[model samples]
Target: MHAGLNEVTLPAQGWMPTLQSALREATRQQHHRLDHHPLLARLVRPGLQMADYGRALQALYAINAPSERCIADYIAAQGYAFDYAAHQRMPDLLADLAYLSLPVPPLAWAGPRLDSPGELVGCLYVLAGSTLGGRVIFRQLQSVLPVTASAGARFFAGHGEQTMGMWQNFWAFAATICSPAELPAARQSAAALFERILTLLESQSC
Candidate 1:
């Protein structure tokens, strides 16, 4: 879409438009519930703040950054494997996040074989959806970041239909639990958590 930047290409179909539609629909569906849900409100505030951290992450990884290369090299050296398609998804997702102007939290690169991908996925879903403003941000990141077709970047690209489905389920669960009565409290809590997440991300900067 924007000129140049051959390393990353925008989809011919304009993924951002689709992504925006999804976000708008999701937000419309959830706003009423979220406004009333005390916990949900508390969660959203911090989630918004987390967008800043997400941006920081993008800056760290934007092509030509030494730190970004360092991370890729480290992952390779560590022999961390990843699915190619999944890794490719990362740039688009990051791009979507950038488009939305959402805060980009720093990433926590746990090694390839964590005890449980399911558990980690669940946590990521909650943090991204409730704490960081849901799938829109994730999808955006996939769209923008120029992930290489290599083993090291596979972690970002590999989440297939299954992962998206699971994330949707998590959103449903969050919707069920959030209430307007608890929004005030939840907003405060979310702010605190957002700060914590940012602090954690900044620490990872090389």
Candidate 2:
């Protein structure tokens, strides 16, 4: 599960494309590692086991619960009009855990820093982009696991039909708010978040 262990490099400076595009290009390697993370990749496997799915859920909860709080608090304190609460995954994770009769684990020891707008946007980019992937995973899980949007798979089901729309909205907002000077931090934070999740998955048995 050493998915995101490598160092990150910032994209070269020049005439900028979209913020989301720049971040994606900067973090492509880390993103690929996270996509192939064993705990997550197994969800779509034909032999996917309930125990593995449960462990993945718990691991996700550990990272997402604290990360959501950190993002929410930052948005509120800074008066950022990002509508941060609307994108929360903690409740869905909790629901899925309860449906599976699994205990809610403690938060990760730490969360990614949201100290600046660039940093916060980077964190949001990683989190928001995941909802898009969740939709795909949710569909895959349907054939392998006894779960649904309202049951043990709510976390992956994400924003349901609005997942794509919400993702677009996030990037649009990010483009407007994330300035060029802040891009380095944004890129670093996004890459760091992927690494943090990989580290947590490896270290935590839940």
Candidate 3:
């Protein structure tokens, strides 16, 4: 355990990997591959309708809602150094569901409770990466869904003008907190999360 970090205290001076580079190295390849997964391809397909939109949101909610809670629990219970405000995304997702008049889906599955700070950090990397991608989807969603940020686009609309700033804030936080030895678990966690999301989407896709 890292001497300063083992107890989950405030940020301390030490060697740490740049969160962005570390995650990019450990997760970007898989992240890129997952983006091209067939289920996701259908999301941005032309002529997508509200029914299709709702289905995608349901699948995503199944994966995101519980998984985020598990991640939050892991962080709160320990010295997991992170930006709590930046990590808060479930409300946006829930608001989107409400806007669409859809019931929040029961949890279909969550990969695992990330118990370790390292593992939780890994999950953060995966979740944070999604928000960046969400911005891209936001534009596509507007073209088809007839929803604005105040309507059904909360999840994809992201932090809006604060999107890049929030990403940078979270990325900077990650680099300082996760140690080199602990990063492998974080990487594996990220891969498992992506896989779980893919599986959930597959189950929901027609």
Candidate 4:
């Protein structure tokens, strides 16, 4: 879950790649860990249980709910530099929590330090990336859990038919606003986010 790298910098030419590309490279190792994480590792198992899924959802809600609120507040105070709608996940996460009878985690905790618009855009990378990859997770959960978009699992289902559009819209905004200098911080934020999720889930499921 550690970043494992020192200061990050772009090439001498400073060519700005797509926002998705930068984020993927930044969190590449953490992203790869998805296959080995205790909770996500169960996805490949045929008999994945609701209890395991529930625990994972609970852990995610803990990290995402509060952080989403913080990001929203930051944007509201600073004025919108990116599209907030594409980054919305708290409602869906709460829906899943309610469906599973899990206690709703509060949005009281502080969030990542998004002091700059680019940093805020960086946070969007983490939030949006989860839902982007969540389509696969949604299918996996549907295969085992009795959850549906209505009953549960809306966090994974996300924007449903509009998911791709949401991604495109996010990228359009991010690519323009998230600059090359901010890449390092953005990458750090993304990696820290993954680490935080893994840590919280590990602690909870223990």
What TM-score, over all chains together, does every model reach? Answer: 0.31, 0.89, 0.84, 0.83
- Local distance difference test scores for all models: 0.36, 0.80, 0.73, 0.71
Compared with the true structure, the alpha-carbon lDDT of candidate 4 equals 0.71
Q: Which stretches of model 3 miss by more than 4 angstroms?
A: 1-19, 79-86
> If both were scored by lDDT, which would come out higher, candidate 1 or candidate 3?
3
Q: Ten residues in a row with the worst lDDT in model 2?
A: 1-10
Q: What lDDT tens digits, residue by residue, belong to model 3 across residues 53-167?
A: 8877878888788778787776666644454656577888888889889999888875567766567778877888788888888888888778998789888888998988877
Model 4 ranges with Cα > 4 A deviation: 1-18, 81-83, 106-109
Best candidate, TM-score? 2
Alpha-carbon RMSD, candidate 3 = 3.7
lDDT of 2 by residue, 1-206 (tens): 11111211233222235676789998899889888888888888899989999999898888877888888998788766567778888888899999999999988766766888789888888888888888889998899888989989998999998898888667656655667889999999988888888888778743
User: In model 4, how many backbone clashes occur?
Assistant: 0
Which wins on lDDT, candidate 1 or candidate 2? 2
Task: Give one digit per residue, the lDDT tens place, for model 1 in 1-206.
Answer: 21211222335123334333433443443344533443223322423344343444453333213222333443344333322222233465455455556555444543222122222222223234432333333444444444232322222333444555544443333232223343333343334333433443345433
Separately for all candidates shown, the number of backbone clashes (residues 3 or more apart, or on different chains) is: 50, 0, 2, 0
The model with the greater TM-score, 2 or 3, is 2
